[model samples]
Target: MRSAKLESMIPAIDVRNLKKSYLPINRRAGGKTIALKGIDLTIKSGEFYGLLGPNGAGKTTTIGIITGLVRLDEGSVSVMGKDIISDYRFTRSKIGVSPQELTVDWFFTIERLLYFQAGYYGIRKEEVSDRIEQLLKKFGLYKKRNSKIRELSGGMKRRFQIVKALVHDPEILILDEPTAGIDVELRHMLWDYLRQLHKEGKTILLTTHYIDEAELLCERVGIINEGTIVVEGKPSELIQSLGKGSIEVYLSDCDPEKEALISGFSYVLEPYDGGSRLVFSVDEPEKSLSEIIKALSSNGCHIHEVKITKSSLEDVFISLTGRAIND
Candidate 1:
């Protein structure tokens, strides 16, 4: 019953067979670089979805195509059952994007900036002032309504970008690195507010370098690489796929015999600090740890220390991507 009810609601964003490429201005002959290669994905209504990838991973291109900023070279994109190409006017209205760049006009006051945005969407004059005030209060910016964008702190400026996006009352909000430059406290505050918004039934598509933030807020995540999606699942599920936990063993002596025994058990064993440290993943930590310790002791290997820890989203990313997000 629940699955059927959920399916009854149209997806907020859908892209299929998406392909985009760019040609360098100086080198027109065979200098084309593909951004998105036959990508297919969907974000359902009222879901907080995270899109994560390294730089040059087609994340920006995907967002650009959906927001109607970049024209797609192939495939189709739809928002709320409306095709972006055929019904872009209506599709764009349903989405509000907060880009990574500070693209707002710093000359305008907080109040006027929001009003200007609402005006672009053709919001009624009578409804404009009241709606702006309400959104400002919601984002803790009502007191700075008359303050110019330059006067506000970086955190406040970031919050205003969100308020400006919401001024249009969009059904789906797309935030690209929304909390990039903000401090930890402000990030947590914004997280709480975003959770409240999600509870109110707003669909969100977030692309961020902060893996921890994605793990905390998003229900599902899609990790893209080399112009294609490599993995898609809930954060917990993805981390679970790596293993139950990780075990780091520090040996007193570096022995090839001991190294071979540890390597035999784990597919992902790394030697750190001159082969004395052996880090590997295990499916059952309790059973595996006992077995590993026994094998080492029986083999005349001296074990100095052992530490078992749970796998994190970062570990999963590194395992899959073969590199870090910042790389």
Candidate 2:
């Protein structure tokens, strides 16, 4: 293992001008499909980063290229300062990837499966036995250690997949939709565990469709759209740049003259609930609320209720991509 000081100085993963395309199965259909369009990305050691995109946005392709599962048509990639292609073995040894799909031996017991995973990295059964046991207990799967993969529940399988990735104790973890299709409680449990791993200084690269998940867990996020990264920054900073809080005012009644008076203000307004509810987008809701209320009162407009909504990472995503992350 590299020293902490040394690891802190080098990036966990780096890609430069990455481009990839897939050939059509039949030439009669159309041209080749472009998956990635010359994207650059870097994740620092011990940092938790998120890659968020819609389906077919090249997120999985990027992860595949970095983990040596898929061949890249163009560009260079490095893992921990070593060239990924030339130093494939060294790079592969440094990463533990829990892919989105469940690809495990259904016939094998949970313990046996993890033992084989560790053995693939040249770790003996005796050497990783304690580690395996510890992981099973940590994930609440210790009682089912003897159960076969096919017998475990969906949530159990997800936990086991993460355990398999950690068996060899790699320096970096790559999770692709780790919480997809799981129950809310299990997802929260996984989040807490991932937080613990980050606290332990493990570099993590997460690809998720859940926008709020990225906003809550990731230190920085890159939003990919149409096979390219459209934006990258801290969640809070991106929200501030591209989104504005909205103030929704509910009125008892709205007349043409009152509507005209409300529309006169320098704010974006939209009508809801048959023009009785007005939504105004503003930079600062707290500072603008008093003025808006006073203006409405002086104009004989009766305010029923008011709601202030802050900008969120999801709002920023929609503003940049013009579509929801899951869409």
Candidate 3:
């Protein structure tokens, strides 16, 4: 039997039958584009969840709707059991969004921006200064607090965006491309802070082009494509489900006509190294390698080198989407 307290802990986010579409400005026939096709997803409380997809895959539109930026055509969204529309105030209060695009008030100083953001949540006047100072120092923006938003460097501005989002101390953090365009050092710094926040029981929803980021930080992921979620699972599990491993073979005299024959034995086959190298997935690497070599040798191709590539989150993503996230 489950305890009442535990059962009452509803998912941090619950989206049911979510749908949205856009029509042309002139309202021409056949000019409608569907952004979300009844997306159904859930993120448990205190969970680090990743929403992944290629460009124009409806990732941005979904985020906008969840953050109340885009109105939904149908369906309901809830945050911690509160309806997003009916209880807009309560649900909105729990979420802090860091949008993909860099948005900042060029007029306000970093300090003032944080202060103003905190004020939106009605933070007590006495505690606003403390909250702002704490976030600035945490994000390494204390010294740059007096700098205008336009005066700060790109990295500083990114960090300040995170700081502003955190100023209100929301329970759910929604980050879209949080580490995009930042240097590796700043990215590492942000990753460390995000990890700390997750450990402290904050629910995080991250959308990024970096596969490794999702693999490292997200406990679970949901991949969306063509305006619908195609797969959802732990990163490792998704990869393992595809196959045990992959084999890369370089042939001295490769036959393009034999490519389909090799693909017949595996789920994926791709040409590399100007068509001289062949990479394919396999359930049993040793057995598959032997068979591949035998087949290639019969085609008058000399094996130059062979290597096994371990399955990874990136592979799983590519397998599902048939392309990379940025592509």
**RMSD of each candidate relative to the true structure:** 5.0, 3.9, 6.0
After TM-score superposition, what is the CA distance of residue 59 in candidate 3 from its true location, in Å? 1.1
| Two-way lDDT contest, 1 vs 2, winner | 2
TM-score head-to-head 1 vs 3, winner = 1
Q: Which stretches of candidate 3 lie over 4 Å from their true place?
A: 1-4, 247-308
- Please list the C-alpha lDDT of all candidates, in the order they appear: 0.85, 0.89, 0.84
Sort the candidates on TM-score, descending order. Answer: 2, 1, 3
Candidate 3 lowest-lDDT run of ten: 260-269
What C-alpha root-mean-square deviation, in Å, does candidate 3 show against the real structure?
A: 6.0
In candidate 3 the C-alpha lDDT for residue 75 amounts to 94
**28-134: candidate 3 lDDT, tens digit per residue:** 56678888999999999999999988887888888888888999999999988888888988988899998888885768788977777878888866788887888
Judging by TM-score, tell me the better candidate of 2 and 3: 2
Sort by lDDT, best first: 2, 1, 3
- Model 2, position 48, has a per-residue lDDT of 96
For candidate 1, give the lDDT.
0.85
lDDT of 1 by residue, 1-327 (tens): 997686547788999999999987678466789999988989999999999989899998999999999889999999988899889889988999998898656587889888788888888767888888888998889999999988888999899999988989998999988988889999999999889889988999999998999999999999988899989999988987763686788775546344556555773445556556666667656668887887776766678789998777787788889999988
- Name the weakest run of 10 consecutive residues (lDDT summed) in model 2: 252-261
